[model samples]
Structures are given as structure tokens and as C-alpha cells.
Target: MDMRLLVGRNVKRIRTARGLTQEELAERSGFSQQYLSDLERGRRNPTIVSLWELAQALGATPVDLITPDDHAD
Candidate 1:
């Protein structure tokens, strides 16, 4: 499985669940809107710092964003 896609979908799901827009998440995560869009589209491979920031912005743990649901352990 592609970790990028997994992370992207998880981030998108969580962000939407929190009623946050891409721009809002970007601002909170200290990234550009375009960058956040790329991440949500699974078009960007984020660095560890970026992943941490994104997780924080979404109020999620890095593992929650990166791990596959079935393989969360």
C-alpha cells in the first residue's frame, strides 16, 4: 500500500470531520494552501516535520494519519 495515499485520505477525512477547509488546515499547519491541496490529493511526499505539523493541525497523531486502518497496530 502507498503510505502517501493512506496519509492523504486519513488527513482529508479527519480535516473534514473537524469541519476544516484546506486553507484553514494550511494556515494551522504553516503550509501553503497549494501544498495542503497536493497533500490531500496524494501528490506530495511530506517530510517528517510536515507530517507532524499536519497531524497537529488535524488534532491527530502521526500514526493516525500514516497507518493503514487494518494495520494500525
Candidate 2:
């Protein structure tokens, strides 16, 4: 699987698990809602700084955003 897609999926999973809306996460991360949408859709490549900020906003570590999910066979 592509890393970008993996990261996007992780971000979306964590965000939803935390009960945060895209708009809310964007506000907390100081990013635009459109940009957050793009990130979640795997349409944007986030910089390290952006990832850090997003992780902080999501109450997660940066690695959590990029780590691959464990798949069940």
C-alpha cells in the first residue's frame, strides 16, 4: 500500500476515533479545512512540520499518523 494512503487512513481513523470533525481538527492544527480534507483523502503531501502539528492537534504522535495499520487476514 502507498505510504500516502496509509498516512491518510491513519489520520482519518484517529480523528474519527477522537470524535473530531475536519473543521475542528483544522482549527486546532491551524490549517485550512480544505487542506485537512485533502490530507485525509490522500490528495496532499504534508510536510514534517504539518504532520507534527496535526499529530499534536489530534493528541497523537507523529508516528501514529504514518504507521501502517495491522490487517487481519
Candidate 3:
């Protein structure tokens, strides 16, 4: 899978695991709902700052968000 898609899926998984709605994540990340949706759909190219914001909002590290799974490799 594409790296963007991988990251998006990972973000979504973490958000769900944390029991947060998209709206809540967006609010905590200081991002728009549309933007968060786009990111989750892998339709937006997230900047480093955006990634950092997402990680912070999800209580995760950037490494966790972007790490490639061994199964994928």
C-alpha cells in the first residue's frame, strides 16, 4: 500500500482505539473536520506539522503513526 494510505489507516486505527470521534480528534489537533476526514481517507497530503498535531491529538508518537508493519514489509 502507499505510504500515505498506510499512515492514514494507522491514524484511524489509533483514533478508534482511543475511543475518539473524528470531531474530537480534529478539535484536539486544531484541524478542520474536513481536513481530518481527508487525512483519514488518504486523500490529503499531511505536512510534518499536521502529522505532529495528529500524533499529539492521539497521544502517540510520530514513529507510531508512520511505522511500517512487518507484515507489510
Which candidate gets the maximum lDDT versus the true structure?
2
Which runs of model 2 end up more than 4 angstroms from their true locations? 71-73
- C-alpha lDDT of candidate 3 relative to the true structure: 0.84
What are the candidates' C-alpha RMSDs?
2.5, 2.2, 1.7
**Full-model lDDT for every candidate:** 0.84, 0.87, 0.84
Candidate 1 Cα misplacement greater than 4 A, ranges: 70-73
Give me candidate 2's TM-score against the actual structure: 0.90
Q: How close is candidate 3 to the true structure, as a TM-score?
A: 0.88
Cα lDDT tens digits, model 3, 1-73, are 5767778888888999999998999889898889888887878888788788889999999888888865344
Candidate 2, residue 25: CA error in Å? 0.2
